[model samples]
Target: MTWGVVAIAGVLGLATPLLVRPLLRRYGVADDPNERSSHRERTLRGGGVAPLLAIGVGYLLVLALGNTAAVGTVLLLAGAAVAAGLLGLAEDVRGLPVMVRASLQLVIGIGAAAGLCIAFGQQWWAAALGALLIAAYINIANFMDGLNGISGLHGLLSGMVYGALGAFSGSAWLTATGIVVAVAFASFLPWNLTRPGLFLGDVGSYVLGASLASLAVASAMSGISLVTALAPLAIYLADTLVTLARRAARGEPVLRPHRTHAYQRLTDTGLSHVQASLTVSVFSLGAAIVGVLIPLAGLNQWAGAAVIVAIAVVYLLLPRLRGSRLPRKPQTALVDIDRPAAIAPRVDFYPKRWIVLGASGFVGSAVADHLVAAGHDVVRLTAPRLALMPETAANPISVERALNSDDFDALVRAFEGSDVVINAAGRATPDSPADADLYGANALLPAFVARAASSAGVARAIHLSSAAVQGRRSTLDESLDTSPFSPYSHSKALGERLFLSFGSPDGETDHVVIRATSVQGPGRATTESFRHIARSFVASVAAPGNQPTVVSSIDGLVDFVTRVGGSSGPLGPIMLQPWEGHSAYDVLSAAGGSPRILPRWICTMVLVVVRGLGRVIPEVAGAGRRLELMWLGQDQRSEYTLEFPAMPNHVLVGILSNREDAS
Candidate 1:
């Protein structure tokens, strides 16, 4: 009789998804996408109903076997599944307000918890906390459901554990019901393959969550061991709990839709929903195996739980770890400064399909240099790129019609296979720049980039803006929430907004906007790389005297077209004042500490001498001899005063004037 009932339930349960799969797909019943949704595609879902069908079938079978300890509990589960499923279904279709839906969940979750406690002889407080636990568990499962087959896969594994453990511990009816449920999920596997025929709906996730929590309590009651049953679910639990605490502290709506989940982060980086979903499924199954074998392995129940918890603890930062870090102050610094909060994918032979906006300019030059060094293939996009001009402007050009040109088509073709798009180029020209560069280069470039990135399978889109967007400031930090003022700055802000708005065709690109400050480095070849041309001063000052000038700060320096870099064209961040000779700023910066009483006259005079020679011969600029002369003894002299003012450091002055004497 039990077998007959189990067979009927499994068949009926699995068949529901098969029946509704087509409708779900046709109607586009999917998890809605927002800033928080893990998935980009609106896949067919609402598949959780099948599991309830299995539970109902299993419950009838339990009843047929006579009212045993398992029969009563199985019936309770059937009731819980019915309630949770119905609630979740409503949320899916009608999009119930969170408070209302959560209220329903709270009641159902509480009832499920209370009934389980009654069966297990735990206190009401257990039921109360258990209600929270069940809610959190379902939340994790819901949170974990970004990828395809994950919920179903884990559900199947967890169900199998319950069945085996129940049978071994003399809970045959429970074991029988669990086996039927697991088989039901397995039976429906084919329909839910690729893109998911049906989603488990809130109903399925809730039922599974309630079932797992109930199973944990029952397992402890039946002597299967608490930790053993609990370990497999620990990773999911830790993620949900920590998020709850974090969101609550931040005062964001706890039930609000957001992609803060670790699983969602994994899905963000070009991972197919199935790949990420399977990764966790594999872990759950492994956890289940370890959990089941704990007693056999001579490990304590708690020890098994510890193993699961350990993995969970480490994954607390999974989402954060998945994306590459961005720069904190993107505007001020030049170059591809990575932020600690950002995470990047490291795929071997990772396709180098990324876009650089101002590939022909200073900032673009620097970014491309490092990106190439970092092993990325570069597709340089600029307005005049189509015209076959020698180079793109430092500002936006009449790149207006370029968007409609065949060149734009080629640009799009380049991004089709790319994984990321870095918008290093922007319009820096003021609104009046005769080149028609400002509006076209600054305003339209982003849209063009966005279109290119979205069309090309690009998942990560980074927009480079100017720290100037922060308003006239010498320095700015990441936390400041200021507004823009200039046409160039306004255009930058607008570009970011546009990409964020219409950036992706499928909304896969997690649009990232980084506003940089004075960008300077060897990476950016241009007039800008010369900002670090002053870094040569540091190296010169640091170098031992009489060193080769070729080895001086000027060796292998980054390059660029001065005419382009010097223009206030559309590229947002300016080159900053190119190194004119090291200022006091450069001197102290080279000293690497608070400035002491270095002779200013000596250093200035030395720089004057070397700079004069630099104009004649690049190799002579700030040779070690000049740096040595400056460092030795440049003190203020007041010979007319009765007190003998220090003219210079005698030992160091002697070294500068007489190389043999210094030696």
Candidate 2:
């Protein structure tokens, strides 16, 4: 199809903001940045009305071209999405309660499903799952609207995916829908940026999300599992699920109001809205590309599932990858008969003068041990001892206080005379009603410490930050700018800045911020992502062929943290995977189990392309994933590799065997 649809739609996308901007003031439909909302200014709330307008206009334009049937389908779905979006619109115009909005969403979802392309004939399972996915996505999309251009950009990329995958002939309806969505997204984007006129009101987001979810369902019906079809959206999915589960467990209204999603965290981490949006877009787009190819590569369903399983594992692991999960089974004591003269071990490792923030955590403990073993005196700092350590501290110091202003003095006192400092502190809080104290301690607090370090002329600092700071749900590397999608990430950047600014000659300090993929090793892990992977890996292996909520790969990249007093090795530069690039199953395989998300053959294809990419375009990533974003009409495989670095044949066989046995 001609690019006109996307081009025109993009232009019109801006119109919504312009038109709605005036209406917002007239109707008093605007959001005030305060305890529960994000924006600082009183901006228009129903900007999503623009895409609805665009869709309507597209129909007028296309109907004259004898495309009435397609227009009817497009409008029906768009109308349903719009109806659903009204929930957000009502909330936008007048803050509605949660139960009210959600009840409306369920109604809209069911109604929209009835009017969907299933009328043309769809698999029964696809219809049901698609409806649920669509409805869920509507909220996901709406939830993503926390930052500027995020939800809009998601629409843009998903539109591109449809354009790439839907065949012009065989899937003309979808092709047309893609065109309409493209035009709508294009028109909507400008308004989101430069200046705001229209917001993709809940209506816009719902339509975008619901429609995309429907497409994913369609793909799943082609026999691809939800795990594979929805891979591109994994970042969002994983973050949303984690945030929801965390909130739900706490009895917080998970669906109500909270900017705790990973994307929200990235935005908070200090990246601009654009940076955060692009960061997420990059990975999601790449994932969508990789996901589409898995099943097409002649890898059987099981293999594809394995690859995807690996991906899900990585999503949770990358944040905890730097440290090893040295979870040793409590040293079991053997009978005295076998050990008549047990020798006492020598003093091998010393407590290094290294300080660890969030020391009580699993990875933090591992990191502390690593430094202490290097022979320097080490000090461990935890967020006040809510729960004291059971075992005696080798060199552990629990500094207790609210991470905010409360503990700054005590924290300062603890930092004195420390050589290397590693901040592994993090917290889970919604952005709106923020845990300012924790945000300060975990995110802003670092900056405060950095400022102190600057004053004292302290030299070395290594800030351990999550890959979530990169944003999106896909593969990423250093080339991409920092995109903090949530409050956590936003604060992370602030903290990192404190270190960098502290190190600057002007600021009087210098330090290095190591953005780890994820720190994994041992019990009591620092990150929920790693724990989730562990849990999911076990669950997936136990029930093979069933899709897990997440996916990544064994060949996925991981970062291991190793440092010294004034210097560190591998400091030059290396690739670190975002949430999407670190494979969970691969790491789990390090234990035992076949990955159920990504098949080995499919992964082999991607590995080949990644290697060839450096030689071809000199860009180290995404070339292959980029290819995956296009129309899935054509199915082909990349040449397979016999071997890949780190991923050995033995591990592959072991994982597969384990998977079968577990199943």
Say which candidate scores most in TM-score: 1
Task: Give candidate 2 misplaced runs (Cα > 4 Å).
Answer: 1-8, 35-38, 59-64, 67-75, 95-97, 115-125, 196-198, 218-229, 250-253, 294-302, 305-663
Ten residues in sequence with the least summed lDDT for candidate 1: 548-557
RMSD of each: 22.9, 21.0
Candidate 1 C-alpha error for residue 319, in Å:
7.2
lDDT, candidate 1, 144-260, per-residue tens: 665567777777778788787776666775586567657666655655664435567777787677667666655654466667767668667766667656654443334445565
lDDT string, candidate 2, 230-336, tens digits: 77566677667766666644433344575656566555556777887887787667666666565445445555556655655464444334332321211111111
User: What is the Cα-based lDDT of residue 491 in candidate 1?
Assistant: 55
What TM-score does candidate 1 reach? 0.48
